[model samples]
Target: MASTAHRVCMAMLALPAIALAHGEIVVDVGHTLAAPGATSARGRSEFEFNLDLAREVTAALQARGRSARLINEDGLIPSLKARPQAAEGAAFLLSIHHDSVNAFELQPWQWQGQALDYNDDFAGHSLFVSRDNPDTARSILCARIIGARLQRMGFEPTYKNGRRRAYADPMHAVHYYDGLAVLRHATMPAVLFEAGVIKNRDEELLLRDPARIARMADGIATALVACLTAGQPADDEATADGPPLQPVVE
Candidate 1:
């Protein structure tokens, strides 16, 4: 008869490996409905853009045989501080957002004979990761992979930040934003994607188009699949000593 330890080891070996395709992915819409983020050049709320893209991304992931959840509760349900905790068991968390420039950069314009704010100076998408997260390495890896896919899909990345912006490198199109609440607090690999600069007149219209949104969703879904299947990157170090970073409104 086998020893008790040997029997236990054998039983452990008999269990099947967890499949990456079945891992839970939480797609977080950037802001609450009541506090909808930046306004687009056309007067559209950023929350609308974030919610739409997050839903599409969730659908795309589900179609690819991945378990995806969208965490888009109203301001009353899960407060901003609670959103990340809501995604506790997820393997990955992706927060979707639309970018806007500083007020100083915004130029006054007349759209349909009405005064509107617009900023055509900067355009394109951006990716962000928080070093404060427990899975910072995996988060960075995921961000890089998604950024690469977005670029391959013919979408450029924004690299222009005026005086006030400090989180991004601009040159690499990926930012190390330790202050972002969602990314910083997530226990799993977390990334925040600024899909595009909505303040740019031309980009705002593109962001509203269903076809473009779908294409971007497909790219994001593909990146998520690749990241899971490829496994987490080699750098799995976790840091807990840094000063807590402030949260930046998306």
Candidate 2:
């Protein structure tokens, strides 16, 4: 009886070590106030969307007992190359941004008496990896895992970016965008997630929904843990430990 008790105690004590094996993940909020990536159908800046979702993702990762941090949370990261530099020492880097359509696809509109442009043609999320990265293999692996998980969570992948020329995994919509500065320059495996096309009015509203934000964040967090510990034995205790994240209020 004492021997069984001792073994049980040892297994309980090992949980933290198991959780720490995944290392730190840096969640990069793509774009800055000065150069916000895109404008939403209603004229909101993409930086606003990126920052909010990145925070939720970081929170979700932490809830899983993983070490995750956020960079450019303040909207001050100055340059493309500098984004990855800020993520040094992390095991993985994920840059988050909302998507947009090409200028030709956008039509002029009026919102709240202000002129705006919007495209209703595109309406889903996309994932990108850089073949030029030093850790391209792992980057692709991580992106594929994320893409698959996102789809399973009911998030559709969109190819409206017109850059489906090099899909690392077409079914899940993971693309190889070789020149992306953040992915190319990262010292660790990295992926750039275009969360959804904000220029699509319907998608813009959906992306802003608090419950959907929580779902997306939770899905990404679960996928990251799975990717980082892919070869290890399944830990039912670890996988089932955390509760679903609450909807983000902001």
Candidate 3:
């Protein structure tokens, strides 16, 4: 009878560790419907791009046996300040967004007989992390792994900042965007992914491609699984100070 009780206790203790192996990841869809982010060269909203990619990434992670959730809202849901709160207890949080240049870089154009904006100058993806996050080291590590995977899949990392010269701090293709509220406030390791420059006509078409999005999703999932499985360092061992930012190149 004692042996049976001991065996049951051991089984219960082992279940949680096994569950921990497949950690929960929150896939945040950037921006809200009422305030959708950057408009594409072809007239698509950044929110559309963010939602599609977030869904794809969630699917990819689930297919790999990982627990992933998409923080999707029906309408003008949560504000930026409240978004990070949804990620509490998650092992990692990834905010998906599409990139665009400043107003000064926008060029006048016509699409379907309507005046449109376009900026084809820069064409690539970018990753960001915040210095204020409690788990900055893990955040940086996760970004590096994701950036490396994206590079391996033949996707380029965007370094172009349009007219904003201060935005040019690149370290291993990951930029330090410390002011971002989502990354700064999230309790767990976080990363903001600018999948690509949607304002570029050619890149807009690429972002719309289902195959391209799937490939990108695969790369992200691969990196995430790798990072989680490798395990994060002890809080004391990791530091908030990230790598030195290099000069911005045109």
Greater-lDDT candidate between 1 and 3: 3
Q: How many backbone clashes does candidate 2 have?
A: 0
Q: Give one digit per residue, the lDDT tens place, for model 1 in 1-250.
A: 3344543443342212253346799998887767898988888889999988999999999999899998873434357667788887777889999999988989998777778899888898888877566656566667778888888889898876423344433443777777788877776768889999999999999999999999999999999888776745542222211333545543
Q: Could you tell me every candidate's TM-score relative to the true structure?
A: 0.83, 0.83, 0.83
The local distance difference test score of each candidate is: 0.76, 0.78, 0.77
Judged by whole-model lDDT over C-alpha atoms, candidate 1 comes out at: 0.76
Off by over 4 Å in 3: 1-21, 73-75, 162-171, 231-237, 242-250
Per-residue lDDT of candidate 3, residues 1-250 (tens digit): 1244443442342213333356698899998888898989888899999999999999999999899988954536567867778877777889999999988989999999878899888999888877556666667777888888889889988777423323323544676776688887787778899999998999999999999999999999999888777746444224344432433211
- Flag clash pairs in model 1: none
The TM-score that candidate 1 achieves is 0.83
Query: Candidate 1: misplaced stretches above 4 Å?
Result: 1-21, 73-77, 161-172, 232-250
- Which portions of model 2 miss their true places by more than 4 Å? 1-20, 162-165, 231-250
Q: Please give me the total number of clashing residue pairs in predicted model 1.
A: 0
**Could you give candidate 2's per-residue lDDT for residues 1-250 as a string of tens digits?**
1244443543453323233357898999988979888999998999999998999999999999889999999899878888889888777899999999888889999999989999898889888876556555566667778888999888999976546446766787777677778877787778899999999999999999988998999999888888777623233212211211222111
Clashes of 3: 0
